[model samples]
Target: MGQLPTDVPWDVNWDKKFESQLEELKQSGSFDTYRKKTIRIIRNPIREGSYKSENLKGLKTAHVSGNYQDIICFELTPGVNHQSQQEKLEEVYLHFIDHWDNYDSALSSRNAAGRTVEFTIEMPYLEEGYDVERAKNTVYKAVKDLDGSRITQEWGDECLRLTGEVSPEDKDVVKTAIPTTVDVKFNENTLF
Candidate 1:
């Protein structure tokens, strides 16, 4: 488990994939009320509408605003050792933001197009003092060894995202390439 900083306002950040989705929402003008509401989620996490996610332990989801069509998924870390009496979290990591209706579809992508499938490896951003440099070096080394694979890591505020394509044969290689300490997720439909 990783600990979060005790900084005020709880540093909030998102990954590239989430940013891409957010950009689409911004362009379509659907996120007008989302920005302010997100601040609320970061400031106060255990509010009425927010719910502890069943599948993703330690994470939660809450609507951006009242009856809003957008949803925000984030992980909130509490202050160290319950030293403070207040209920404020030390950090808020934005995992994703999407139209409420697209969740079902987002979880339903077809089999990953092996030989050309793009992979994104995500690892939570831990508080400083963690071996971040060594971890990065390990990933870089593995990426270098990948033959014909074009994987790149894009670090995010919430999670480190490594996005790139791998061939069918190299797909399995990817599984072994990244360390088991890293957490990787694909659409629900993806088997590998």
Candidate 2:
């Protein structure tokens, strides 16, 4: 089995499909954004609630990206050395940077290596006059009831932004729970 170095300059093993997807990102003008996000993730893979990083529930994998347009998914495997009694961890694999539109299908058909699927929802900027904390808690509870993970509540543009991962079937439950006046929007990754 492979072992990851514990110190600086951590190991990162990229999957075979990553190269082609990277080249495509470059051609499409998202390379710069993707590069920055990737670097941030590599520097601190374990950080939680980051706007640029998220933990996918079902797949047992984490992804780093900006605007949710392009995603770089990876899995961290833990290992223990019995003889030396030392704990070790490795970012066993870095999957391809999948586009949002194809992410679901690719994730469904591809080999998850025992990882499951998770549906992420982003609700950005609630309308004025709504209690931000109350609204966030309500949505958070709704998602939690459905077994969601990586729930985050933050303030953006002076308004509340909530993001979390849930099962595909439970997406409607959370959506319906939000008040119509809030203008909840999903991250479709379309610039137009």
Candidate 3:
């Protein structure tokens, strides 16, 4: 996994805010409440196929989409290892949206310090009805073929199971562990 940029494009200094909120959340026991806004799942291409003769001799060209979402995350602390945090957030986020919204996948991470997570969440151009789940199936095969393994195989498999495509006998899984609360008595102004 690559590193998410520390210099995010937003007005808020999310890093500082996250640290402050994390402290408060630790005290209050409602950590999930610290999440700023709804995390969005953006698609990133995992791989593509070529029409070349040697590589395509016995194979046909194909396009593959990844199962993982590009999360636009807002956090309450810096202690969360960036990559792991993004991945974990995606895990819980996918389940939450699958149950609550028409969400497919997401790529979430914190913005710059002062910018509100709302700025990105409120992007006017953010189109809904995106086929994130479909993209996941496409990407899974592509990613598996590219590196001989899937980047988010576990997540993909779990999603399939949750949607009833796989059997419990196939794998041991836990898909509903997302935090549900935060420390502060958050009002609109508090933002967490």
Model 1 TM-score relative to the real fold: 0.32
Model 2: per-residue Cα lDDT over 42-153, one tens digit each = 3223322331224332222334322232333333344422213222443333334444344334332322221222334334454565556666778877777553234666
Mark the regions of model 1 whose C-alpha exceeds 4 Å error after superposition: 1-114, 127-130, 186-192
Per-prediction TM-score = 0.32, 0.34, 0.19
Regions of model 2 farther than 4 Å from truth: 1-129, 187-192
| Candidates ranked, most accurate by TM-score first | 2, 1, 3
For residues 1-192, write the lDDT of model 3, one tens digit per residue: 123344432222224444444455546754345332223112111111221232211111111111222223323234433433432322111112212122213123333222111000111122244343544454343333431122332333223211111112211111111112211111111111
TM-score-best of 1 and 3 = 1
Clashes of 3: 34
Itemize residue pairs with steric clashes in candidate 2: 58-116, 59-116
Each candidate's root-mean-square deviation in Å?
17.2, 15.3, 21.8
Better of 2 and 3 by TM-score: 2
Better of 1 and 2 by TM-score: 2
Question: What's model 3's overall lDDT?
Answer: 0.25
Q: Whose lDDT is higher: candidate 2's or candidate 3's?
A: 2
Q: Would you list the C-alpha lDDT of every candidate in the order shown?
A: 0.44, 0.43, 0.25
